[model samples]
Target: MKSRAYSAHTLSALVLLASLIPLASCRTAPPARPDTAPSVAIDGSTMYCTISWGKRGAYTLSGQAEQLDGSSYSVTLERLDWFNNWQDGWTEASVPLEGKLLLSEAGGSWTASKIEKPVPARTSAAQIRHRNTILEGNQAADLFDRRLERVRATAAWLASESSFSPADGNQFFARAGKVLFPEQNGYPEGTGQSAVNAEFKAGEGMKWNRTYTEQSIPEHLREVRDSGTLWRDWEESRELFYIAYTWEK
Candidate 1:
């Protein structure tokens, strides 16, 4: 009976050892690592992304981000009309983005995030002043040109009339004079009267009739007049004559 019991006990111990082997193997095997690399793609207005820690890519952003604390920001991804054409649509999303991107890992994606350090201003005070001055000058010149065009058009119409009276021409010139002399109408210094007077004086003693031709007007105005200088100069010069004749009347 004792010998039989010892054999049974040893068999039971072997069975228990076999059962623990699979468990031991499981514990010793290494854990599978997660797939963690940054990637992004766009389809229409939807943006798909697989961004890993500490990386960034190109993106279009809108709205403001809170600088005081790391907060969520909004971004947009535009879908191109064709592979080589312009964007036709866009997608938007709000995400908690913080810290400056160290490097760009991919293209065709938009990322919106806050940086720890604010970006330095690209334009200086002097540069802003210079740019503003140029814009203002351009605006002033455009206004002057438009006003001069209206005057020229009116003069041309008057000249086309078969019986243009000097009295009517003088009346028209008086009304349009303010536009020709912008300085008198509150324009700044240097935005003085047009070169019309100078041109008229240069062409002094020239025929002051409705028969003025393209060859008669000043070259400067002739060059820029839209409707060829022939009729324009004829009308304009005739009006100038009326202006001079009626000045002392």
Candidate 2:
């Protein structure tokens, strides 16, 4: 018993030390919902999601988006790419989702959570963080390109597992601007926005591979991973984080 006790103590101490190190990063704490239900500005940004401690035992997270001028902003908690679908969108009051109550509608404090979807190793957060960001004006555009790439990959992943089908890729991207990435579509496009797309890229297979896959061979996603400058050329485009969650608490 004494030996086990010492080992446990040492383990706890190691865990704490690891958390303090950037390399030992942990999941972010989702925002908290307001208890008094104050009037939160609906201009842009501001979203929420659920952070479960265990199975269905969690609270809702609510927060606002912070970003540069003229661009969009958003905030949200974790979510799931249940069907491998992704959305490059934003949520003002809660995490972004479909067939859900608006943050304003829910009112008051709620449970928080997050949606963790598998991203391609090449396009993962760590990878993008290391990418060249030398340009000024094109910095935002470059990030957008990275984001769109991830979005497309995740959506394609989702489509494979879900009834979504292949033909839905472009459709998903088109409607995603409105459904998944709502704030971008919410505003006129570029008045401060943030969006999130928490969907796994459904690997191409007869059955959905719960594991991450790579480019089938040598081909790559055209237009997204050009290894050069990328511009947001959508007829009208905006930035937003994909975050939101269901909170029954």
Candidate 3:
């Protein structure tokens, strides 16, 4: 089949978060028995239930991080409900997962959320057909992986530094944003199927720049707690300094 030309725009991103350097992390949902853990548990945070609507489904996972040297810590989750859009009667809340992999490291903790699944997009049969064609046999995988490596290196570099560090929090976020959604190669088409995406950037293009200690978390969280409406839902904008994006290209 003749390869169709695809638009060159970046949309997908890979995030390599630093596992909180804490005494411990994670809090799984209450188990049926003492030995069973229905939720995911981190230092102090907990995520319960499947990524379904407001209801805590069979699998609940959450994590908490207590700074090894301090009392104040941060908690983050990468479960189905992490979207924070969890609502009552929210159906089709998750993709049928073969199984979930609990990933924990010195950096912190993270769950697959959807496990290599693309957050479904609204596309017509015609659109799907078009995507199937143009997005195929392209070097998108290479670009995606390359992007991930860059993010990993960038994150690692940032995490290694001390106070007044070389990379600021906001700066790290900006780098992350770019890594997840590079302006160069456009979005990745598949998690996987082929290495079509890998043909573009082999060595490197933009050496990610880094800076440290910068943040706008306070103002962000305050706005969320006071939004009066989507307060709990008001998780984006800044304090959320965290995000994930998937692509089918």
Candidate 4:
């Protein structure tokens, strides 16, 4: 026999797969009914799920069981958030579990029979045009040269913010429903936006050098809302502030 080594990425995938194994192969004998819970009380039964990604951290899923029947149930789960162990906190939005899962108990664990997942959200051509229009009016220079790294940095920061915000995880991070430019991370108050902003700057090599409170400043920004596919997905353009502007030194 020969020894083998697995890379961190490979090990993470393995762990995630292992966590899902029980969901697929669950089996069990008839369960004892509790005196307090009725036969169909499963409708309101909630389940919390966590999928570990080894060093990457884990994803949390939760939802109540609906349309219960015997050991069978229809579960509509929403991915709560992604905890990035590397960041010591939630850092990304996870694709929400889509479709009603037809679940059944086999080995004392609930197993999904049929499931559907949503596709990732992408910036549409229309959205790009709208963003361009706004920036154009303000004579903002496009950061096309650093698009790749900047976009990647932007995505990570946005996901991290979404994971940390107490507001609707599916909506874009905003202040009073608006994206404030050049401010200290325009999130709700007392939510440690400064801490997150520091991390974003240090880790991503991006920082805001100016601030504006005038009402006209917002006119130069575009807020495009779209369908969100994950807990980390952005529903508006405010979530992509980095992509929208390239603050020059």
Give the number of the best model, judged by lDDT: 4
Candidate 4 lDDT for residue 226: 16
Please give the range of 10 consecutive residues that has the lowest summed lDDT in model 1.
Answer: 77-86
Worst 10-residue lDDT window, candidate 2: 209-218
Tell me the tens digit of each residue's lDDT in model 3 across 1-249.
111121122000001001111112221221111112222222223222121111222222233232322222233333322111122211111111122333322333222332332222211111001111322112422322332333233334334334212133355445443333232323223322222333222123232111110121123222222222122121121212222211110
In every candidate, how many clashes are there? Answer: 3, 47, 57, 6
Two-way lDDT contest, 1 vs 4, winner = 4
- Alpha-carbon lDDT of model 4: 0.30
TM-score, candidate number 1: 0.17
Error of 3 at 239 (Å): 12
TM-score of 4: 0.25
- Candidate 1 lDDT (Cα, whole model)? 0.26
Judged by whole-model lDDT over C-alpha atoms, candidate 2 comes out at: 0.27
Deviation in Å, model 2, residue 112 alpha carbon? 12
Q: Is candidate 3 or candidate 4 better by TM-score?
A: 4
Q: Residue by residue across 102-167, what tens digits does model 1's lDDT show?
A: 212234332323233212211111100111132223443343234334434445544544433344
User: Please, what are the lDDT tens digits per residue for candidate 4 over residues 1-249?
Assistant: 111233566445434532432122212212111111111113122342332222333323334555455566665654322222121111223333344445555544444433544212221111012211322111211221122233344444443453333233234334423333333344344433443424221112234322222221222221211111111122222222322221110
lDDT of candidates 1 onward, in order:
0.26, 0.27, 0.24, 0.30
